[model samples]
Structure formats: structure tokens, C-alpha cells
Target: MADQDTDPRLRWLKPLVIGLSVVFVALIMALIVGLITGVPQRRAEAAKQTAKPVPANLSPAFAEQVLNLPRNSRVADVFASGERIIVRVRLADGTERLFALHSQTLQPIGQLTIQVEK
Candidate 1:
């Protein structure tokens, strides 16, 4: 009689091996997806935290002043020096004005028009 152990039909072994292999592959895929998804989320949260507030040293009074202007009235631009700050303010009249301020006091240093854009 032929030996039963040597016969090819070990029916349970094949299905169990296949099931284990599929589970292993699925686990590996899930791990890869979690790692890729986590990185940008962490970076974006860190960026949002850093972007929340400007440092008080840059211009405390100027920052406060600009907050009260009409939402449309904005800093057209800014130029800075060791002792002074040059800011361009766009008025609601659709006109632009330039003001140079003492950086330390946020006080006016000089005022001049650079250009007017209609």
C-alpha cells in the first residue's frame, strides 16, 4: 500500500497557507498606507501652529492700526530699514499713500508717494 503521508492531498494545509499569505499582504499594505498618510498631516498641523501669530517686535502699533482699517484697506506693501519702515496704504478712495515710520516707535519718519495706480 502507498504511504498516506507521501500522498499530495494535504487539503487543509493549502487553504491555511493561502489565507495566512493574504492576511500578511493586507497587513503590509495597511502599514504602508498609514505611514504615507501620517507625514503630511503632521507637517500641516505644525505649519498652522507656526503661522498663527506674528512676532510683537516687528510692529505692534502698526499691526493694531491696520486691524482697524476697513477690511479692504490693506498694506499695499512694506519696505524696512534698520531705523525706519516704509508702508504703502491703499485707501478706500482707490488712491494709495506712502508713510515712512520710525521702526522703534511706529511713528512717522517721512511720507512720499511712490506711484498711483488707477
Candidate 2:
């Protein structure tokens, strides 16, 4: 029994296996706790995202006049943000431009000229 207890073959392996098992169990516990706590927070964030409304500053005229797109330009897409609104327009010249407008005043705050590489 004493010789078996002191067996060199499994001396390192026993401690290594025990240490790995402890770490694995600890990680599993942590994952379970994270899932429990993270669900509500993620749901709340999703609610906030979906509940976001289109701002009053966003409109066709605002996109045309403020963004300086041609009269024939039309809104292709709209992106809402907390501080600003992004409007993607298809212009008469067959080019695409992205306009970032201020949320309150609906003024064009920034612009991006988009081009496709051949």
C-alpha cells in the first residue's frame, strides 16, 4: 500500500488531473452564472434598440435640402442613432452619398461619398 501510494508513474498525472478538473468545474460555474445574469441585460438592450423611434428631424425634405442631394435623389436607407441620423441617398447622377444629420435641427453634419471599385 505504501509503495502504491508513492508510485512515480501516476505521481505527476494525479495532481495534474485533479487541478484540471477543479479548473473545468470552476469555468462551468462561471459560465452558468454569466448566463443567468446576462439574459435580462441583453433583453433590456434589445428593447431599447427596437423601441427607438424615427426622429422628427428625419424627412425627405431634410434629406434633400440639408444633404444637398439632387432633386431627383431619393432616400435609399435610413439609420437612426442617439445623436444623429444617417441617410443613404441614390442621386440622379447615379452616385451614392451618405449624409449624417443632426438629430434636433436636421442639419447635415457630415457626408460620405461612396464609390465602388472596379
**How many residue pairs clash in each candidate at the backbone level?**
0, 0
Residue-wise C-alpha lDDT for candidate 1, range 60-97, written one tens digit per residue:
56555432244576688899987778888887777776
Identify the candidate with maximal lDDT.
2
Give the Cα RMSD of candidate 1.
10.0
- In candidate 1, how many Å is residue 57 off? 18
Residues 7-98, candidate 2: write the lDDT tens digits.
68867887799999999999999999999999999999999988866667554455355355768989999998987899999887778989
- Model 2's lDDT to the true fold? 0.82
Q: What TM-score goes with each of the models? A: 0.34, 0.41
Candidate no. 2 TM-score:
0.41
Q: lDDT (CA) for every model shown?
A: 0.73, 0.82
Give the lDDT of residue 41 in candidate 1: 99
